[model samples]
Target chain A: MSNDKEWKRKLLRDMVVIRTFEETADKLTLRGKVAGGMHNSSGQEAVAVGTMSALDPKDVIATTHRSHHHTLAKGMDPKLVMAELFAKATGCSKGRGASMHLADVDNGNFGGNGIVGAGVGIAMGAAMGIKQLGHKKVSVGFVGDGGMNTGRTWEAINMAVVNKLPFICLVDNNQYAVETFIDRVTGGRDIAKRGAGFGLPSFTIDGQDVLKVNRYVKEARDRALAGEGPTLINALTYRYYGHNVGEKGQYRTQEEIADWRDNRDPIDRFSAQLISEGLLSQDEYVALHAEVTAQINAAVEFAEQSPYPDLSTIYEDVDSGLLGAKS
Target chain B: MSTQTETTRNTLPSYSEAFQQGVREEMYRNESIFILGTDLIERGGHFAQVRGIAQEFGLERVKDSPISEAAMVASGIGAGMYGCHPIIDLNFIDFSLGAMDEIINQAAKIRFMFGKPVPLVIRATSGVALGGAHHCNSLEVLFAHTPGLSVAVPSRAYDVKGLIKTALRAPDPVIFLMHKKLSGVRGEVGDENVLIPFGSAHTVQSGKDAAIITYGYTVVTAQKAAAKLAESGVSIEIIDLRTLYPLDEDAINETVKKFGRVVVADEAPLYGSITGDIASTATEENFKYLKGPIVRVGGIRAPISAHPQSAEAAIPTVESMINAVKKVLAY
Candidate 1:
């Protein structure tokens, strides 16, 4: 086991950073800083931080459109991410991929897909590459519960299991697909149970509990690396805001939001754990907030100063002509 | 005694044999290229096209899937997107609607989206010989209209071999459509050396009277119709536009200039047939080459009728095509 003090502080910092950055994005949206629709991962920070902490940085991970947390948790420079949201040339994808499709492939981040359930297949393919090269790395595909029912997801899952692939599907189940509650659309309340029927090894956990989520992620990663095949983990969490910044979701009432925010908020929960364990003082936690705020402000400044991509980017990448030359 | 006696070597198989042979060779050559479809294994494929493929390729690479059209296409896209080069068989073209999203949106867009092209082969066979409405339809025009996909309707075995070989090497996903009626129809094919370029169209027969232009199963029909017209003192040029999507518009234009009259025949509905596109384009741009208006022949825009008399009236036939040629001559 690692030192309780160091691990707890790290998890707390990650949760705060993720929450703060996304909140800043919401503010930017209000201020006309961002042009496109934004999918907020405000209430789902712990899953990203906890799962990423357990995996190796060299290991490849993929996500769907709502992928700010995954990118930030993987140690991307906040300034670059902010610049990307700003659609600046200095952004991570060189201002090409805005929020829904940000990518820093050189850092082992497969870009997020705008299409549902697309990344599940890609993750298996990446794992197959790792197998072909005889490497110890594994792949993690983080998708939402809405993507679980797609035919492509099933295709990838079946192939992953049959090939004995070293892949893990991190089910980021926030209990809503935009506005529809999970129960309204799906049969059962649990997504991990559905995964079990696919012949995948699975587990469900309190996704807001950073420490607990990290423990299971580590176990899954080790099992995958040893060629034990894929594992599906249904992360049980909640979202504080609507699907995007423009949403005013009337689906969930005030009572539910109040309860989840007060009791199960991951950042506050992790901080409490740190303080109770004598790892972080109250003043130290307060100071960490100030530092995170400064970082967000600096990121906003860099984004404001950055340039948009030139129009020629449209024709640059579609064809490399590797298969055969076109006449 | 003649001391200089030379022995000539003969080896290449016909085009269809080469395609059938290539599947076997490539399966043996690479472990990852899998051949999958519905009931293909027990039926030895719908037209015996993949007969003995499983025996030579083994069960792993040659697998039979359920009757789930969307699942098969989605899986093929998934597998191929990662690393596997999958050759998927849609038993009939009409059922392609079920998996259109997977085929059009996901499989075709990935290369352009991620800035890395995915190489996959999609094989389809379609027609109305059978009584099943689900099984009886000609929808090649649907795929030909999709932007990112490349499609081919090989009218002969030589084309089957060359195009399949070429399609296997295409980084962009391709649809290899073979008309069901032309399955066993044979011709001279190569063993392993032919590369049918995607946009190359061939003029099968040359004539000054008119050009009978078409593709897929209609090539043979047009040729038969041309033969009938030839005996009646009509010279008709039969042109086969093998590749559909990256259509050889240039060749079609040059041929139209040489032969001032043409009859565009197809198996799809006449309303939006690829024949309509060609005729409309030629009329708009190559009006100078026209000594007569282009005649269009195809299904009369209705579901294929299983009843023989009604079915005969539904889609275009050899006699109907000949009638169309006469109409073009009058024009």
Candidate 2:
């Protein structure tokens, strides 16, 4: 919309890479190559890509179990992320944290948390530090609809609001948390409206649209950096697959899933919009998809060839002083 | 406790004041160090362990938090992850149960799980002083059982100052347990700037007939027992394990080898207590040196009561330590 062709292309490219990375991760998880459960970020690509694109590289992010897309969008190396998923020594966490706990603090990605709404407090703490250090950086915490209901999330939001920390509590309301629908569990079913209880700029937005997500996040970032306090955003989106890779998804209807996947797919909608706006060509989109697919495949190869951590190093990194530095 | 050599003019400060002195010194030394806890700013902490710190370092660093222990702890973990050394003050150690998930799952494991240093300290006032079940809890074993957390239980003013300074500078999360009863207890404090390394044992009293290994408030009880036992010609050695996680196995072994009889005591309940760890280490590491079955003196397996007599009977007393020492010396 702003006539920034290169920037639009880059956004599209980042989303494509996330989608490819998630899809490949799903395949690997399905094939039993990756250990443990993997929460795919396939349908929620716009949330991670759009939100990350709105912030500076120095800004930090704390995400949830469904964190592959966020990790890639946050500028983590695909090979390192893939190797982490593969539980290899070459992984970002050195094979310690698999799918659920992927973190690279040096890259400003505080890492993916397994506990619901846990990262919100972490992000709040980072914001507290940022404010104390007088840094103009923002910290974003990504949670699901279920994580929104967590008591600590509200507690953290209240503290952030009171302290006016540069924080953003971004909720990806994918309509379902595991097998339960959000409405079935959440009372009143309005996550954003509750933000007024703490007196902050809070709203719900169309998460499937990249531009809207980016714009909202950009405004939130601006408010945070300006010392206007925290923002709570509930972005409504959907998941294309089950909660985990191997679930039957009996909790959701096939028609509903099909409708979201076919009609409301974020990447497809954004690509179409980009093409119509002359920001991207159909031929270029196809080439970009192929390029990202090849990159993801190469990452898989690197993960496959990566070595598992040695048994002798089981106790390593438990104490920082024991290991002079990270191996 | 004659441990660190006298290098500067010694001052007699209460346990709580020494803790504040340690925190104040560290806050001045490190700009990244900040404190988050309940009643820290207005009430100056329930135990006054952080008294005058808010005025010294400003409210931004020594900030008060709501009653949300979980969020407070998680925030500290997050801040520590971001290169800020946060001292999360849980007013009472019993209240730490509210944030077990954050403490065990997040703070304790994040460093190991993420392969990054979390320079954070969880400061809590521990031990029973007729505070009842809700207030009296010695969770040293619970934290000591968990890996990646350095547990420091300082009984004296000197150890409180030095150990806390070390905890503030630790590259990992440290559970700094201060005794509630010892808050007003006065003791000799060492140099203001020196730090006491964790895992080192302080020899409270030198003896040869028997050894009583203890920490926290139990150290005082052990000292009383040693005084009584010394009159009976059973010279008992007292070893104060300043930090429990790095359990000072070498010191325990040395004491075991020298005395050939041992009694491990702790204020926590005997079931799943750090006393078991100390007793096991004594037998396991110094089996040949031991002359008798290692006796353990700890709190009774029951909820600590508010009644003064019942509370006194709940945790290890001077009489209990005397019995434990005598039981081991029978060999």
Q: Using lDDT, give the best candidate's number.
A: 2
Instruction: Give residue A196's error in model 1 in angstroms.
Output: 2.8
The alpha-carbon RMSD values of the candidates against the true structure, listed in the order shown, are: 4.6, 3.2
The lDDT per prediction is: 0.77, 0.87
Query: What is the per-residue lDDT of model 2 for residues B1-331, given as tens digits with 9 covering 90 to 100?
Result: 4544332224467899899988888888899999999998877898888888998889888988888888788788878888899999999989889888788888888878787888889999888886688999888888989988779999999999988888887778889999888898877777766778788889998887888898988888888888887788888888999988777778888888888888888878899888887888678878998898899888899988999899999888888888888788788
For candidate 2, the per-residue lDDT at A293 reads 93
Q: Model 2 Cα displacement at B67 (Å)?
A: 1.2
Candidate 2: residue A325 Cα off by (Å): 16
Q: For residues A95-128, write the lDDT of model 1, one tens digit per residue.
A: 6667877766556677677777776766765675
Q: Is the docking of candidate 1 incorrect, acceptable, medium or high quality?
A: acceptable
Model 2's number of clashes is 0
lDDT of 2 at A125: 79
In model 1, the runs with Cα more than 4 Å from the true position are A1-13, A56-62, A74-97, A103-111, A121-138, A149-165, A225-227, A278-306, A312-327, B1-17, B25-32, B39-44, B57-60, B66-68
Clashing pairs in 1: B14-B189, B15-B157, B15-B158, B15-B189, B16-B157
* Native interface contacts retained, candidate 2: 0.54
